[model samples]
Target: MKFRRKHYTDDTLLALYKAILKPRLIEEKMLILLRQNRISKWFSGIGQEAIAVGSTMALQEDEYILPLHRNLGVFTVRNCPLHQLFAQFQGKPTGFTKGRDRSFHFGTQEHHIIGMISHLNAQLPVADGIALADMLANRNKVTLAYSGDGGTSEGDFHEALNVAAVWNLPVIFLIENNGYGLSTPNNEQYKCEYLVSRGAGYGMKAVQIDGNNVLEVYDTIVQLSAQMRENPHPVLVEALTFRMRGHEEASGTKYVPQVLLDKWSALDPVSNYEKFLLQEGILTEAVIAEIRALIKEEINVGLEKAFLDKMPEADTKQELQDMYKPFVQTAHAPANATKTEKRYIDAISDALRESMLAYPNLVLMGQDIAEYGGVFKITDGFVKQFGKERVRNTPLCESAIIGAALGLSINGYKAMVEMQFADFVSCGFNQIVNNLAKSYYRWGQHADVVIRMPTGAGTAAGPFHSQSNEAWFFHTPGLKIVYPSNPYDAKGLLNAAIEDPNPVMYFEHKSLYRSVAAAIPDSYYTVPIGKAVLTAIGEDLTIITYGMGVHWCLEILAKHPEIHADLIDLRTLLPWDKETVAASVKKTGKVLVVHEDCLTGGIGGEIAAWVAEHCFTSLDAPVMREGSLDTAVPFAPTLEQNFLPKYRIEEKIKKLLAF
Candidate 1:
């Protein structure tokens, strides 16, 4: 417990003691409440207070922190009022998330803390993103991220470390290795001698520290944080400790060996720290008693306020409204602006280039997107114009890049991620669905990011490269999906997606990238996200489609000009133009939904169900849906063509028209 040098004075030491002491008391109180059935759950960091307290206090106050569930000391150290913290645990309306989430799951922007998701190591890459903001702005700021020993085994752990290492982000990745991950012993968790040793593989500096030694933990982090600030690099600091309790209060610690518990019990961090404070002449018996008495009073007052606070009443309307923030276009094209015909891909490039210039906070990250451009050359010249910081070429790690985008968004930067292909997004699915999509709803942290997905099949690129996977994200809440068929809509929609304050999935059809062309405006303009375009207006039937389907239906209509139909291109999938569809369905009295995805569980099914429910009285025939057959997209041209709905779109339109 001896320190080589002391960074803090007597006053600072006393403050540190209070910071460590309060959370210890709080954990004890929470356990009592849990046993009394007053609280639903508790993850007690009983013997591990040193790791949370020392590391947090060592960092600069303005620097960001991502704390795990067990790190209750972080909130106390940050000066969060105990009453509000209790109210959060109590799920009260006055809580941080306003009762939307429970316990330490919610993040408070005021504190510069991003709370951890249950998928523990996922926040590692996010820390890199926050550091990226600091690095880009040349700020001497560092990020502190925590994960359990078990979390080190996840793919996100490796992805995050490698990303930080290669980028040289200023982040202190602290692993609170408490010997077990929900009763899974470290003996079975990793084969390596120590988690810190694994940092060598990523070319990161790493060290192991005694979790029970507050002075050692605090000094090590203080020095490490200073080093990282001076020379911007990630470090892995593993604090070896033992959890004295179960994963949760309900899960009894019967699995733990009695001998191990005895060994750790004598080395309890809170008590051990108190002894050190006494030895250092920082606290007398009377002062310690007085501090304890004051904490009890504080805890009592916090409990009173929490118990008096009213529970949040569920409001469906408000809940749905909170999912997405209103996006307003700051820039627009001239009303009578001159236009020229361009390919869909060129239009996307133009819109992106325009957005980068219009919004200095905007940044783009993807694999092979910088000097080499993208695989499709969408961002071919981005780095030359916007510089490497904004136009970043990330490693081939989808999850890390996506999570980093969320991190950048958290720090007031608008980030966009370009998935090499649509199907490849599955690698980053957890980050999109769980982290980015849930951030705003969980804690009002807006993910001002746009994920550019190159989607659809037609070029015989096979299953991995080509996919119409909007349906995967369509089912997830809190995500905006946009698909455009022509160059005009592509530019407008892409701009709108960038303008949005939430996460947007902008789907660009691979086949239509070079084929589809239209007179795109020279200036920037945003198409409203929830609005659909009527490509060809008619009264025969309501033909709903998007991406490549819009062109298919146009050709079908030209072949038989007599069979006129309302060809509606739903540019945005989520928060779709339902009013426009309902109006068209009522006008035509029949509905046909077309998509390039497989027939079963396709977006067409959802549209058809809605049409059947709302436009049943107006329909002249049952809602017909045409999609690719339920099978993998083949590599052969004919097989791939047959696998998509491109050939069947004309037949579907004609059948609905005749019906």
Candidate 2:
């Protein structure tokens, strides 16, 4: 087959030949290992090597690249040590994330190659945020985000493109069209003739390229990257490549026809590029053979090193440390005020409104927040007070909503993003875990964003509408998790969260939103971000809780003043106030942990275990825990009251008193 070639240089051809050989050898060895049962599974970027290499070469060393799962070629070209990549694939301790992250989530910011998120299309908006950061910082570094054609079908993709284009961020959304997303083929993935056309609707610069042709891929990226740098607008570069292997290790080519594979195989990018290199006089047949042998040898060494790498230690103690990294000590508040007054929702609103006034850079955005004052009315009158620019309403795209907020914060604006309910936050979890949590630690990219979601049960909204998912964020590092149970702490802790340099997941119990009210102080203040507050001081026993549980425990204390129960409300769960908790438990000589989340791996378990380990000497009896049952929060009001942790605080307090 004859292929048309345009202006091409010797260096470009040589680069292509090098790029294609590296991944091809790795894939070849991976297949061999898979057949020999040396590894469980493998996914090869065999057919798509050219696009990764060509596009990456167009980028500056300081620019960022977000690769997808099948982006080994990009990783290899960017000097991501092959041994580390394979170790990550093997789930070894020497992996980039110290084996805490999965294989695809591997990257070193030192190489300006940001990690990839396994979820499709999730990286697009994050790329926009990173690019926006560069633009605001007056840096010329662009961010190139790669995803599959199927990813274009996700709402995140459209939302990200729209925001990036509208803001004119310097980002390139590279969609490698390998024709199938798992078992679903391109025909099923979209009705639109092509994915890049979606960008036109969003007013972004879009182009389609023959991804298998290294020359075409490089030339096209050279043009797009240069244009994006100058204009500082986002563009979509759809690289039409072919996935020669199965979707993953477990998947087989049975779902796809052999004929199609043969057809795409005929256009083998490595062989095509090898021919191009020789034809351009950039390489002789001897040089190509030598390069292939060198790449294979390099792959063999990396594979051997990976096999010899140590497995990650599965010790819970080590895991705990890994889970709670980036922890900072926060000063606890003074003795509980003799007078306590305020409603949790009112306190939250005050915190947001006051923070906006105090910090000009602090902006608040959400759906129906500007006029409707939020579905829960938490931000009532905020828009009127802060103006449209500062307190704006966004479209009904949850993924985009948080994505844009992240982008804003990355650009030096402290953004408070409110998801109507915690349940809906699943739409933006990819952005939260993959992008927001890791950005700062990965590339020194700070994301000072606050994500407020009303979580927990007792609303009787059923599984989809009501849930407590603090554990999700708690499991992720580089994020602060705060769950305040009262009005005073809500207002104070929220102020601190907004000011903090890291991303924070502020979980307000949905059941506490307006169900009860208290008198919140009018003065602007900040409560420490990772500290607990002692609601009631006593000596007989200690009751630990947060969010709704704090109020419930306080109510129990009010009814039984003679019980001598000490109540500690954990205002922040991530950097939890261990000092305050331990001191209280030591004084009481007995302790009970309470929370509204599920019993299994609930935040309370961690607290109870910690107290057991650290405060066991002072304990007169076994430490107790109270949390919602293992079952899901039911929709029925009566069942919800039983399934939820509304009454667990009282029950636990009674048990402690009896002990």
Candidate 3:
């Protein structure tokens, strides 16, 4: 094969040779380990090493690279230790994820590599966020995000690319078109001639290149990197390559046609590059052999040590405790108090203002968050105060907003994302549950992002607009759920959430935005996340609730003064103050949980269960719950009131007293 020379030095040619050879040898050894049952599974980059190495070669040591499962050559180029990579493959305690995850599901903050999620194209928005952060900090670093031809079909792919282009972010979208997404061919994925062409629709520069040729891949990426450094605009590059092996070691290539397989096998990237090196006189036969032998020897030694490494012992208690560590803050509250009376909405806005001023890297992103000041005016003056760079108004993309926020958070920026309404959080559920919540546990990394959700039903906003969706996140581990009942807690918690080193779903009741007001302290203070506040103390029974339900419980107590009960506001749902609830349960000897969300699968059930399990002997009556009927929230005010009326809660309280 005749190769085009693009003015590459001998050292650069040899470096590329070593880069391709290392991953090829390591992947070949991984296949042997899979056969020997030493490693669980293997996803090979056997024929696509050039794309991985070439795309990453131009990246500086401090720049970020988000690589997929098959991009083993990326780790090699990043100088990730072979023994650690082998340990991760073998599921040892010393692995990147502490052996909790396998095969490209791990990354280290120290390496500046964003670990990949199994869901394809999900990391693109995250990469955009990292680039956005770099841009905000005036850092001249570019983020390289890798995906496959099949990933282009996912909604996240388009959302990520669009945002990157619109913001002119320094992110390179490298799509390794391996002709197949698992078993499905490229034709089934899209009818477009090339994936790179789609970038035009997003207003981004696009290019297509033969990924098999190492020199071409390197030159193209180097040029793209240089362009991105100067202009900071996203560039989509479709590197045409092929998945020469099955998706995983256990997945047979029986579905693939042998002719197609043989065609790609003949154009093997490693072999073709070696031939090019030899023909160009950049490497002699002896040198090529020596490089191959050295890589194989290194792989063997790493494999032997990794195989002997111990597996991590299971510790459910420690794991759970680690997942919910207390939020640590770097900034202190102002010593002098500037007390002021403000509505819930104003309090929230003030918190955002204070936090942004306190932390220069703090960012606010959402639909209508900047110029429009959000739908509820919660961020009314953020744009003018913080400017468009920090207070960004994103497209109507809930998933990307959250995904990008996660990326920014991981890259050392504090991002507060606003989901227009709580009901819409379902759109970004995967990013929240799968990526945001699990990032810390999977890779021991913090997605220090706060998602502010305008929640609850009060103005008859119907099902989609008004929903108490805190329960959706309550069940998800590695997330902190805070539902503030008043302006004081709202401001304090929002500040705390923004400063916290984890993903927090901060729910603010839409009804209470203006209706709830108080003379909140104007000094920075974090309402303890997991602690519940005792509103009214009594002895007959205990009413535990949060959000709008807290106000309803207060209304119920005022109406029926004869029914004396301790009212406990559970501000944080996930790590609910068990001690406070149990102590109140012991004193009152009765428990009743209330909320506005549907009765079925509500956080109330979990609260009831916990009280029953922990304070069984103290309970003088059955643990009861009051919630809306198991149906969609109605649009009509009468129906909405009937659905979750104050009378219904009173009825439950009466029944608990009778018991």
For all candidates in order, the CA lDDT equals 0.89, 0.79, 0.87
Q: Could you tell which candidate, 1 or 3, scores higher by lDDT?
A: 1
Worst 10 residues of 3 by lDDT: 324-333
lDDT of 1 by residue, 28-125 (tens): 88888888887788888999988889999999888999999889988998988889999999888888888888889878878888898888789998
**Tens-digit lDDT track of model 2 for 1-659:** 33345676566567667876888788888888888887766877888888888888878877888788787878888888888888877778887776666666755657866666666777677676667567656777678888788888788888888777766888888889999998899999999878878877988878999889877787788888888777788888888888988888778778888999999999998887677666757789788779888888888888889999888777886654443325463533433444346577888887888788878877787778887899988888877787776676766667876766666664557778898888888888878887778765443456778999888877679987778889878878778898877677788888888877678999988777677777655777778886677788888888888877877777777887788777888888987999999889889899988888898988888888999999889998888888888987789999989887767667766776777
The most accurate candidate by lDDT is 1
lDDT for model 3: 0.87
TM-score of each: 0.98, 0.78, 0.98
Preferred candidate (lDDT higher): 2 or 3: 3
Candidate 3 lDDT score at position 269:
88
How well does candidate 3 score on lDDT at residue 313?
90
Model 1 regions lying over 4 Å from their true place: 1-7, 328-331
